[model samples]
Target chain A: MADVPTKTARAEWGTRFGFLMAMIGAMVGAGNIWRFPYVMGNNGGGAFVLAFLVLLFLLAVPGLMAEVALGRYTNKGVIGAFRDVVGRGGMVGLGVVVLLVNIALMSYYSPVIAWTLYYAVHSLLFTFTQPGFEAEPFMLGLFDNAALMIGLHTVVMGSIAAILALGIRRGVERIVVYAVPALVIALAVMTIRGLTLDGASEGIAFAFTIDWAFLTYSDTWIAALGQALFSTGLGWGIALTVGSYLREYDDVPLGGGVFTAIGESSIGILAALAIFPIVFAVGIEPDAGAGLAFVSLVEVFPEIPLGGLVAILFFVGFFLATFTSGLLITEVSVTTLAEETRFTRTQTVLGVCGGIWLLGLPSAYSVDILDYLDFVFGNWGLPLATLMIIGIIGWVMGPERLRLLAVNQNAGIHVGRWWNPVIKYVIPTVMLFIMAYFAWENFGTAEMIGGMLVLVLFPIIGYALMSVIEGRGEQPDTADLTGGDD
Target chain B: MALTAEVIGMLAFTLLAFWGIATWSLVRTLRQEDRKVEILKHQDRMDTYSPESLAELREWIENNPNDPLADEARQQHNECVDALKHTDMHYYDWSSEEIDRLDRV
Candidate 1:
């Protein structure tokens, strides 16, 4: 007499626009504006971009479609969805990824948000004039004290948790409705202005110039694939968990891809606009692993016109992006706690937020610690998680069942029965190839080794805990946890 | 003091490198052990019933009503039969992709 868990809240989007905007909020974040262009420049600019786009089609979009299908059909978070598709093992694997990735991101991401708030307030207070005079003073104004930035980060994290506590369609969705469009317009304006500068052509050229030789390298391809998965927030289970809330009628896969595409492409383009002009103008070498976003950009900020104002605005945008993502991650943790502990939703939310805040203290205290954590969880944890998710959905659950769940909610475009077979056998094989390729190029390095540990550690720990909790009873038969009706 | 600091840093780096390799080996070993346990569980379950019991089991299954665990039981039954060499498990190989072939048959 095992009972099916009753659906608590039907995660309905207020409108199609709201859903799209929220997806955009989730997809577009710190990585896009900060990391994309610099990485592209260092990695051979247009050539890398082209390769990344190819990987998106061959890997990311299909992978995303699969995740969205799992969410919409099951109407459950990562843990629940995996249990339905594969088994208890799958659930533990996904839970590990989601928890670790969220923890790693929150560690360093909050500090950047604080910096944004600091600059935004400073801009309004007349610390930076529009005429670009007193540039040195503006640059000096920021980072003169680390204490102020840390305080701002704490405040921002609290606000983020509060927004999530308000639930998806009401608070988080509403903010994105306005914020995403504003972000896009701001990025476009900045790009145009950057191109018009005397040294702007050099920047644009630097971004657009293709190095054909680098295209053949396996490392380049791996990096591109990783970015595609990371940028869209896949495998980490945030997107899938959000997708679980949707009504059955929505075109979940299409919606996910559209958001991912826009988010990923905009990041690549916007980072170019912010960085290329300055880097080329200043004669700094563009190297992919040189930590372009924070270190490189801040060094050049003092030279730009109304630099403080721009800095503030840029940080605001950065914070908005990361804040939206942080909010969603917190929601996942809270919801999981509520379901597992039989705690009320409010109690779970409060407890989870407090816990994440406490865990994130080490990261907030030092850049080196934050960087190491990010390297461990963000880089390696996500890809490993994606690989396990693909295996569960594409192999264990049987492709036909997965495909049926995918097509049940909305059936406009017909992919036919071949879809499941491809997902089952073909997709996982491709992911394996990609993962192996990554390991060949990057494994054995200290950073990657730390990353592999973080990725594998929690799943083992989580499964051990579950064995303790539900070990002897006729365990929750993972096979019986099927996705919802079409 | 500076010389001492450099020596300490090198030693820490070496220790970290050693730890990484050890962890990787441990993960690989644990995964192998888990797979072994899963196989053993399946074997023990299969060993619980004989051919006569399986035939009677099949008859009982045919008569019994469908429930959430019905599909699993059937799959496990097939696995058992395959293990006992009573029959091949290819009967369940009919993927949805083979639906057209199934229809033709």
Candidate 2:
């Protein structure tokens, strides 16, 4: 029997230009700049880079296509899409996890964005020109002043909310058109600047240099796979959620590939340029963890002539990067509201942003707790959530049917037939293995494993409870996972 | 640290705020859905029988028996006066606007 074809409510993009830029902005973020270089340094640089590219082709892009297709077809947020196809119980589990992760993300993420604002203002005021140009002092200057940090963070959050409040077409898509391109230009400038520096050869060498032996370590592969997924914003539901707004007529598979490729390569190159030159110039080790972005780099800023200007641009760029990620993070929650409530666009925006703001406090104030939470949510929670998304859409969606959806989405674009195999078997298997491997590698100690499980599983368990409360007990329709095409 | 009255008060206030928003949104959603459902039911009932209408109605009833107007059509079909002979589309005429409206809702 032919089901009635309802009008698929496609949320309009501000423009085709806005659509492209916003998608790219969502894809590019701090991971490309702050996280990529540091992780690359630790792993074998060239070898890790090679495997990462391969993994992106094999697992990440196809998985991304499935998500985009699901979102676009269903025209709903993560939970709404999941529930409509998978039933209420399946949805609750996914929704609660997504909500918790977005909340945790904003908590510390806002503070980091605040840090960028602080640096931007300091650079503009030429505050760093004061004689004492040392890392400890500069680092102390920003973090110690909580009030300053809080104010800037608030300003950044306010700007982000104001833009989101304008609705998707005007606010996000329009602003991102400029923001993303400017970000790319800034990165290019930084890369050129790095190359001109006296020690830039070393910086270039540091990035491109290979450690083939390092590839032998399974942990390196695991890290590379995770980085590929997380850095591209795969496990986050941000891409899928945003892509849900796209019209069915748009070529989704092509959009997915282009977004993923540009995001990965640009961020990869920009991160290398931004970090390696500074690290090489200062004689600092390239492999220092998260601290490299904040602590070590600020120390070197004072010696340069236009140190303040450079710092201002660098941090401003970071702010944009984080802001892009943060907007998507907030969007995940806002979309939940759009699906669950009849609140107008404005109300839903405020509701989600405000909710995140309140939830964000604990992480902002405490680094140690935030670190623990970040590990649990970013590393473990996101992968688990993404795995569910893939399985729900891939296997449960009927393999043949899902392939047809993929083909339909790729009508004008050329995604080879091989995409089906990757989405169905290769991607999910790789994700599962990496997730398990990371869990094993990180959770070695019994106490550590137990504590991590408690933290991560609490949200999952709570979601299950919510599902029972709201769901009308029904098995998820594995056959119709893309919520059926009209 | 031990729980204090201040902390308890804050928790209570937060809970109230969350509950208030959730309840407000839920009511609004349910109301909107109800309005849409009512419109759909009305359209389904007002539709008449024709050759095209008979085919479409038969398909709709067969596929969507749970739809609100399905019972009305069932009663009409089962009426003693209009037994097997009048069941065909020749007995009734339907307007394009009516059919379009039925399709819309």
Candidate 3:
């Protein structure tokens, strides 16, 4: 392996505290708030939770730690880091896969963040508290208002761009340090309020009740695994990019990787605590799908005490979770561009944000496009990239070697030898099984076909365009591309 | 009724405890970092040692084999010599000043 240069100036996280908070902020997002509750409601609740915890510890934690180890060890963005780790050949292809995945995800994800922002402001203005506020029609109205959707989209993307342009310490770290704590506090308050509601125990019992029969269904296992993976931000290269700024001495095993997983999972449980009690107290159907947060919760709020204030708190919390996540998602592209090209950070941020804004128009204008993009990126692209990443770490690099060199080297708590078999065999086997199951179940639909085409074609086009750009000699200084000073 | 109150109390306590632990950990990390910086500052001046000074010290140690301070000089010279290799292995291009600045956190 060629030695990475030692003397290129790169930004580092201000402190371990800042790094941990930023990572926790990245993991605890809209998935924890809206998606986790409904998934638990639809699945077997306590049984699903058990399976999710099992998959998280066995598969997601190791995968997350591996990505973090790769980033910290290489001290470069995904492209340069992958190039260094995987060596010269196949770097561009793998790099494009990781890059395009993040870009495509952010293209759709920003519109959702815009939705939360609009709702947060709308709630604060007492709009939801108005007489006879119809939740479904109102939500549909907002979605169909093209001007408003695009405006909120611009606002969300612009805020992320402004924060990222401030650099790591002043921008990302400062916001997350406050944002994560605020999110938890808001959730705790809402949880207390929900639990205090008159008929809340039924919801809590339903959420925590165990039904072993559901474990027999493979669908339960797949949904649990999907939630665990997506909720923890595995295979997204967002963690990998965040880990790139980690100091050499920061611990990966316990303080960095495992801690982030625990924090994120705990927040998911807390979200269930906050949401289920209210839903049960109001006697709403728990399996409300994507509308569980906006429609169902909005319906429940009007019938309860302090419901207006609680609604404001919930939407505000949702906004914080989503906005912070959008920041990290966009940072992946911003950092890649800044490191790869001769462009200034400002130019890179604006260009990336502007491009995403234009690309996200379809998702903003139509719910069908939004759902389709989410299905393509979420189900197929994310899992495929994650499986490839795990394969690289396991079979290509040798799991034991990665553990020794990347993980245990600077870690505060070293993983046991059990990690070897888990990373090498168990995680990859489960991931392959999940991918096969998804393909078997969803492969025939028109949406699936369209998703598959986008999944196949987006990266090939991205890789080709990237190759052309690299060939045109727009590459930045090699010294800068490598970590450290020239 | 008592059990319901107990459950609520327990849940509230657990949440508060977690927040307390997070705050304590942050404080402890900052304090530990401060101690590390202080120790690094006083332990040795190797971070500031120049190449020419290192070479001169090595030669002095070699020539003054019987001198009283020769052992200490040799130790300092060896440390200075190893510093370059350590720098090469570092992940970030952190200069001594930047390191000091980081320590201020």
Task: Report the number of the highest-lDDT candidate.
Answer: 3
DockQ of every model listed? Answer: 0.02, 0.01, 0.04
**For residue A28, what is the lDDT in candidate 2?**
69
Just chain B of model 3: what TM-score? 0.38
Q: What does the lDDT come to for candidate 3?
A: 0.72
Off by over 4 Å in 1: A1-7, A87-97, A123-149, A278-309, A416-422, A425-446, A473-486, B1-105
TM-score order of candidates, best first? Answer: 3, 2, 1
Pick by TM-score: which candidate is best?
A: 3
Model 1 chain A poorest 10 in a row by lDDT:
A407-416
Pairs with backbone N, CA or C atoms under 3 Å apart (clashes), candidate 2: none
TM-score of each: 0.73, 0.75, 0.81
Interface RMSD of 2: 22.3
lDDT of 3 by residue, A1-486 (tens): 356633346888897778888888888888898888777766776677778877777877788888888777678887776555454443355676877778888888888999989889988987887898999999989888988888888888889989998988899999998988888888889999998998888777666656678888887897888888888888677788888898755666654556676667778778888998999899998754458888999898888899889988888988999988988888888887788777877799999999998899889888789888888777777776676566566665556545644575435444656787777787778667766666677879875786577557766765576557555334432222222100
Which residue pairs clash in candidate 1? A132-A306
lDDT per residue as tens, model 1, A1-486: 346534364446665566666766777776777667666766665667768777676666666667767777777776666656645543454555556566666657676566556655655564544445454444434445446646666787788777766767787788888877667666566555555556665666666566778799876776676677677776667667667766534555455543355444555566566667765565655544224544454445555665555555565666677667677666666655565676766677677777766766666566567677766666566666676666667766554455533532232233345456556666667656655565666779877678667656867765666555545343456655344211
- DockQ winner, 2 or 3: 3
Please list, in the order the candidates appear, how each scores on TM-score for chain B only. Answer: 0.32, 0.33, 0.38
Docking class of 3: incorrect
Show the colliding residue pairs in model 3.
Answer: A7-A484, A7-A485, A8-A484, A8-A485, A9-A484, A9-A485
List, residue by residue over A1-486, the lDDT tens digit for candidate 2.
Answer: 356522333466644445556666776666777777777767876666767767776777677777777777667887777665566564557556666666667767777677666666666776656665566666666666666666666776787789888867877877787777777676677666665666766665666567789779987887778777887777567766877787534556545554444454455656676668766776767655346666666665665545566666676777677787677777777776676667866788887777666665665565555566666666566666676677666665533344343334322244545666676777778767766766676777543474467446845664676567666466554323443221
Ranking by lDDT: 3, 2, 1
